[model samples]
Target: MSAPTITFNGTIPQQYDDYLGPFLFEPYALDLADRIDYAPVTNVLELACGTGRLTNLLLERLPSSAQLTATDLNPDMMAVARKRTLAPNVTWAVVDISAIPYEDNQFDLIASQFGFMFVPDKLKALTEIHRVLAPGGKLIFNTWGAIQDNTAWAIVNKVLHAFLGGNPVPQHLGPFSMADAQVVLQALTEAGFHHVNATSVKKTGLAETAAIAAQGFIQGLPFATAIQEKDPSLLPKIQAAVEQEFSAQLGNHPLRTPLHALVFEASK
Candidate 1:
């Protein structure tokens, strides 16, 4: 079985921001933003600033004098982000992490939220990040933990697997690919980042209803495309099953599920 190619196009970007943004991403975005020491950060770069969840928070924390360059590979995602975040000091660009466009040692801080795992070459991306980071600068990012560790996503994955019937899981190839701490640490070290630290952070994922949560998991993510490719007609059935599972396990009318992720911080 082969993983489906994940693209943040069409309505995926808007749906992602509308559904999963607050539920799965906002908590980690707050955590990532809070981890930064913004006193000396004049120039900042954010990679894969999906819908500007963390980018908005970063702007709030940063001083008026600070400049932020937020970039993502998908213009659709960036469009949503740009609409949400409007600041005079912020510059938006379409960027690929593996080959950053900025000059060497340019940014005082580089941050990403739940984006690194999707990079095909982790070491290459980290090296590019290190190159852009100024001397003694910091890099902070987070990756989702193993599927089983994130309770809500774990349940969703199980339901998806059952529906796919022995097909490859879309998330395994992207979001959860770098779940292992050792793998992340090794990549950072090899990329020449020092004083590396990894922290396991767990947060509560909230959704208004089981149905809505199911929609987020099924349609908002790459899973939607995978399911569509396999059998578009099965999407509704799988989503219903996922909703039922969520209601049974997590509850409805303000669903609160445990989500786990690994946060990494390194100095260049």
Candidate 2:
């Protein structure tokens, strides 16, 4: 779903953390956590810590003395994240990234998973991030590439569009908004982040079965929210179609599909 249309409230957070988090977000979460220099970093602010997919890995990489403040726009997501990653060093809060409520230079590093694209005003959010970060602090985040680059999701989107008679919901079209590195780099630069760099990363989106992948797509994302809002009765039909599509195209055993993303790193 498009960033504007996607909202991880209600049951969406739990399903997202359960299905999509492990299949699509975990590898990148691990990679992003691994990039943390860890030696000197003491204060970290994780924006959009959806269900703590990255938080779980990040905790492992951080030194015991490090302080982590995890924030998300949705309280439902924060609740799930809190239960998943319980630690004395971590503080969980619901925060608006556009107007972050923190003292200047409060954090040494800021990180986000596949959430950068969701911000309504990226430069405003980045400016807030820059404001809260200490000198030479870093901002690390990732965004999905074009829809075509992520084949499985792309196919699901295509199927939904075709099934719904080409009037797919905006949530289905939102996540790929910042696919271009140039746009992201410009936003970061304008927000006062220096040495901005965007790197392409590829990972395998894996599920135990085609049914699982299909179910994950249907239930674990904005697809479910959209369907629930407009036509909840059509769920079974959509799920069946998605399963059949995956089985026909990707086969049933140990489903593995490629997903492309751009990892952006900038110094504040």
What TM-score quantifies how close candidate 1 is to the native fold? Answer: 0.96
lDDT by residue for model 1 (3-99), tens = 7666787778888989888899988999989888999999999999989999999999999999999999889899999998669999999999999
What are the lDDT scores of the predictions, listed in order?
0.89, 0.84
Residue-level lDDT for 195 in candidate 1: 97
Clashing pairs in 1: none
Cα deviation at 245, candidate 2, in Å, is 1.2
* lDDT of model 2 at position 185: 95
Q: Each candidate's TM vs. the true structure?
A: 0.96, 0.94
Q: Per-residue lDDT for 78-153 in model 2, tens only?
A: 8888887668889999898898999999999999998767777778888989999999998899999988989888
**Per model, how many backbone clashes are there?**
0, 5
Q: What is the lDDT of candidate 1?
A: 0.89
